[model samples]
Target: MGKIESLDFIELGNHPEKLVASSKQDLYTLCYPSEKMPVPSHYADFVRNDTVMLNNFRSFVAHRPFHWAWFLRLLKIRGLDESFLEVPGELSYSLQNPCIVAIPHFGLHMLVPHVLGHFIRQDSMVLATGNEEGEGVQDSIEKILPNDRTRFLKLPDRWILRKLMRGYQSSHYPVIYPDVTSSGDKRFRHLSFLETSIRVPLGVENLSRLCKCPVLPVAMTYHDDCYRLHLGPTLVYKEEGSIIFPLFSWIEELVHLYPDQWFGWNFLHEMIGEAKLLR
Candidate 1:
């Protein structure tokens, strides 16, 4: 949250419209129904270069085989202690002071869904994703939601999610994507700027202030033999703006640690441009 050295987004070389069109075409074909098309050229490149970084740990977390063992290992980290692992039990009691668990986005396409399934299965919990979950995403949620235990709810947009969170305490378990932006760089869609306001997604910070919840930084990365999930020290904001800088610093560290994991690289560049304009 300290003064960030500004980056110039406008200086980025303009990508040709034809290249953008081709990338989009390939991506669409890959996601289209009926035919499970070939992996998009762009994503194939990503997998080629970065899949090695994921290694076997990605497979384990992706499939979710030995989760208990994984959790136990995370608990053994010094200073993480008991209560950190106790959040599952804690959720049923008081969500007045909820926890903001920020996990990295690398294997997170898998990790987030797994974490949601894990909580709902064990605790009769209900979790929400995206602004408004589409039918497809909801179908994915249904496959995971337990019959006798947990309830699955989808809020397709932020407005509805906010309203539901206020009304239903169980809705407190929210999987938020704070980084949302339209990048002029079409190559990276669904990405957001990282540095516009020291910490972008100021809304999330505001929510933490209002909820008085502690922010827990979660990271899952390929390490040594397995994928490691590292939970950093808990963060709490004091009454007078004490938490923003620390929270911002924490996010910056996360960005540096897992730069490729962040889907918002292009968005961050856009925010850099906005920051310069305002100055």
Candidate 2:
């Protein structure tokens, strides 16, 4: 297996008790702040209280095993089936026409390729940041998924960028997570997220402009014993300015709708620290 720098890999087959313990500790460290920040008036409804926060934390912990199980299935260690995924028919067009697919770091995000593989006929690339914590699951994904079908490229590699440009020209779908705290290029914009400003990378918009491809906002959620992939309207690039705001606005809606499934909530405070607050 090839290694990408600063990319940590998750050790599979951990004891259930250990997983729970680690997850609880991580939840406490990241999600529970020592000092609670003031919630903006409009953002109050989206804020999670102690009980809801605990529930969300529990949901986050519970999903890890399922993610590992899905990875096992992908690696052929366990039997795999399509019944576990629910994809919308609307995704057919996007799959057919190569576009930049922007997905949030939501529930079971690494399983995206496996779930969409059944529908995607052309090769696709999944762009991930090398610096983000808890992104070790990506290493498992790279090892399991065949490179020819879906290539996992950690950003900041000039060679990969060249390949991505060529791939887009050839109709290969490039999937990216735009809501990350940091990007490979270190380019970011502090935009309004849940009524508070947090750093969002400009990679997605930059790539879309460079490739001249429309951005397809996709959201993945886990519920009812399956994963659901929802496709939003395609966003075309504008010559005048940045699309990061509108793009993230759509993401905020999804995060609000499925707060428990969103992994961002864990480190959200850190992302928002000292950044400009939205009025």
Candidate 3:
């Protein structure tokens, strides 16, 4: 026999799902009176609703379609260079190989990886949701933004994430989603955001520890018909054991600065119980 066989590594991530139906329409998922969020005094005059409950419910439904349509349009255009404007214009130097680019699932979240991967010319793999709902979103995104050195994988279970760590160990770039919530994982580090405690995935910290690499915390926003990305300082390993502290602080600042573009606004209150008080 004069034949040679080669094996390719299996990709564990999946593409992002298409924008799903509004969770607001699901009666069982609706917020209870006691659980409804509150409206801060500052925005009382601007918001038409008396409470954050009514306001959030309305905003959730209203924003759903637009976010989806925006994704669709971005896919159609496929203009990574013109679509995004990164802050600190000198961001290129800091984005080295073997780095973890952890971005918040803020407004224009998907675009974060797309633009970064294309611009930086790095091998990219975004962690996917893996479930039926998540697959739908992925289907929508991949239809437009596929095969540009940027790819998606199924949700990072312990095994899959470890594989990513192995590849990252050898200098492959894995764009991470630090804000995506999964079902009942105790490893998450709970931190306060917008005055409410939100659980953050320990992926960034764990990966950095495993590979001994720093993380690039990126925040993205959509405004005036364009996407803007702000690259914060890199998070190096520290004696404190949690790199998420500084990253969360920077995220809070972004959420505070652009309330509308924070993207998590739709279900954040539901996710965090203490979110009863709005910002």
Candidate 4:
């Protein structure tokens, strides 16, 4: 982790350039594990293009402090309002129904559930891992959101799926990050993403079937000095046996448009191993 001079919102907002520069070395190390090691095949294109890669790294670096400051601000505020987000008018109506909100690991992703709770005006459950980082995010959510508005469920529990099913049955929308890498999970599919294939979990698809609800793809990105939440059309199980491909496909498009806003770029190597060409 790089040192951030201050966590103040205004300070972070004003020193974006400094923030990016300060973390340049650390970001390089994260992207390139070893000087002798070649870039991962899936992320080779981004690395090959110096300008795009630098922008992506800059976004990766600056997003953290900005997100932390935003989180701190949220803790002090009463709650969020429609003015805080830029949602499409038509999509506003779609949020009325309880559906699986499949969000990718993008900019300010940790804030998606809280933002959705504002729009849906209902309680929702967010699925998170039980790791240190996951617990930290869970703690942040607990502190920022009213206890009644949202619930955080850690992953890998046997009854987790049942819990999600019941939550959906009770009209509690389940928020999931579909782009996470699943280890030793047989229920996954490989789909083309960027320059390589990525293994996407079938959990979201299964949950959608069990709950008989559609999967709504959501992305929260930082653009033009504002945090915008973009929503995609509902993906119903009736249309396909699996929505993993289409769901990730939409995320792929967003990543291309906002490569710097995507946090997944940092873990691209773990998601899909170094390309054979690079090896």
Candidate 5:
């Protein structure tokens, strides 16, 4: 945990279109998951090299099984913390003040707040799914985290979670991902990601309003043999609606830069209604 650096891992930023050529094997394991697909002529370079494919796969938070998740879980149970931490000085201050860190479900994201827990004095909690009356999701994630510091709420059950937010003597940073669309609830806001309007949950946005704090879009990925953190613009809450465009754009950029690390690309089209249309 020291001075972190910008992503210098791959050349994806210079030529984002190369993803159309990702290796079939790599795409099968990393992005496409379920079955092997014919790689287009253009995307082959994205996952052609064995080293590049595996390295990018290791950077993601979710895994097919034993590859990424189990290894990290073993490390956590053995008391091994993150390889590093990086956030702007002012961003740390915003954490101290009431603020929401809207993390997208990209890369090794679940561990960010857990890593921050070691450095910051303030209490922190990860807001996950509140199903099973907030018990099921909490159990699954809390087991992997450094401590039992996760909360489960339907997220729309705003008043109860709001009270907990108010009680934070210091900032009890509640981390939540807004890009999920596994559910068909109309409560989820519509957002554009890669020319697709996807259903995104507005839990973080509502929580920010309840706490009257600004939202910062944050992302984490392991690369160059270390952890790399990415920060998007801080959005002040507004009555009009959720500040999702900027955050969605940021994730879109990261997804382009690290296409293999984002697991949702398969179901992403479905979430955006593109899959159904094709049918």
Candidate 6:
């Protein structure tokens, strides 16, 4: 008879803790003022060409009277104030707790912070990443975060971020640019490698799966007056073929359905490849 077999499990990655360590450097971890992001190559190129367009789009959003009014309402509403927001799914299932929300790019730029502030009251810490140049925006968030619940994480600095994540035990909702665009720019031709390669990193995905946390497919659009935060459906991976795949499929559908609001002046074009305009 063979000696009583001792069980040993082989992990996927070469260095499992290293996987943990690397994952620790999330976009949200560092305090704004102190964090520093080393600029990635081609980042400046992307910014140089798109600065004017982005600014114009941002102004368009800012100038909207409805946006202003909605923002004012957001300030007055509490985290649990679903009445003020146009929540789409069932209250029993939709972001009623701490969960990861995959918000589209354009709506995320301005409106997300308000959403974060609202949710933090219920102990949900909204996470975002920024470059060294946008430290001011990070600083502004830090100032507004509630002393009891709200917090901001700057992603550039790795060491500090690792410690922070370990201490806080937060979830990752990586903000990624959708691969569809309106512009014809070919700069992002190579982006297919970056785009579909993986939006949610393996480390982050594994963490969420292991923790049994739900992923809320989110997309917001400022249409007419109110800023609509659309919560599609909650995805929980119970087994091998869980709802994650269907959730991603629906996300792509939303992107196509609201291309204009989602893209906002070809930002998605630069980030991902250009969109094929409908004839």
Best model per lDDT: 4
Candidate scoring better on lDDT of 2 and 4: 4
Candidate ordering by lDDT (highest first): 4, 2, 3, 5, 6, 1
Which portions of model 5 miss their true places by more than 4 Å?
Answer: 1-91, 123-148, 152-170, 181-185, 239-242, 274-279
Give a tens-digit lDDT track for model 5, residues 203-275. 5666667777777777776543355667888887777464766777778888788776665554565566663
lDDT preference between candidates 1 and 5, better one? 5
What lDDT score belongs to each candidate, Candidate 1 first?
Answer: 0.38, 0.58, 0.56, 0.63, 0.51, 0.40
RMSD of each: 15.6, 7.4, 10.7, 6.9, 11.4, 17.9
Per-residue C-alpha lDDT of model 2 across residues 177-216, encoded as one tens digit per residue: 7776344546677777776778766777878889988888
Model 6: CA > 4 A from native: 1-84, 89-93, 108-110, 116-124, 133-135, 141-149, 157-204, 238-247, 264-279
| Residue 48 in candidate 1, Cα distance off native in Å | 19
Residues 172-277, candidate 3, lDDT per residue (tens digit)?
6776666665533357777877666777667668777877888888776655345567887789876444678888888777766765455565456544644434
lDDT of 6 by residue, 1-279 (tens): 111111111110122222223221221222132112122223223344355533433444344323432343344334335554575546334544555544445454434644644443254555544444334444533333233233444445444334333423654333322233221222222212212522222222333465566656666666544566766666676764354355556655665565334443333333443442211
Pick out the ten consecutive residues of candidate 2 with the lowest summed lDDT. Answer: 1-10
Angstrom error of the Cα, residue 254, model 1: value is: 3.0
How many backbone clashes can be found in candidate 5?
A: 6
Higher TM-score: candidate 1 or 5?
A: 5
The segments of candidate 4 whose C-alpha lies over 4 angstroms from its true place after superposition are 1-44, 71-78, 81-84, 121-130, 145-148, 181-184, 239-241, 274-279
TM per candidate: 0.47, 0.70, 0.67, 0.75, 0.61, 0.50
Query: Which 10-residue window in model 3 sums to the lowest lDDT?
Result: 3-12
Arrange candidates by TM-score, highest first: which order?
A: 4, 2, 3, 5, 6, 1
lDDT against true structure, model 6: 0.40
Q: Which one wins on TM-score?
A: 4
Clash pairs of candidate 2? Answer: none
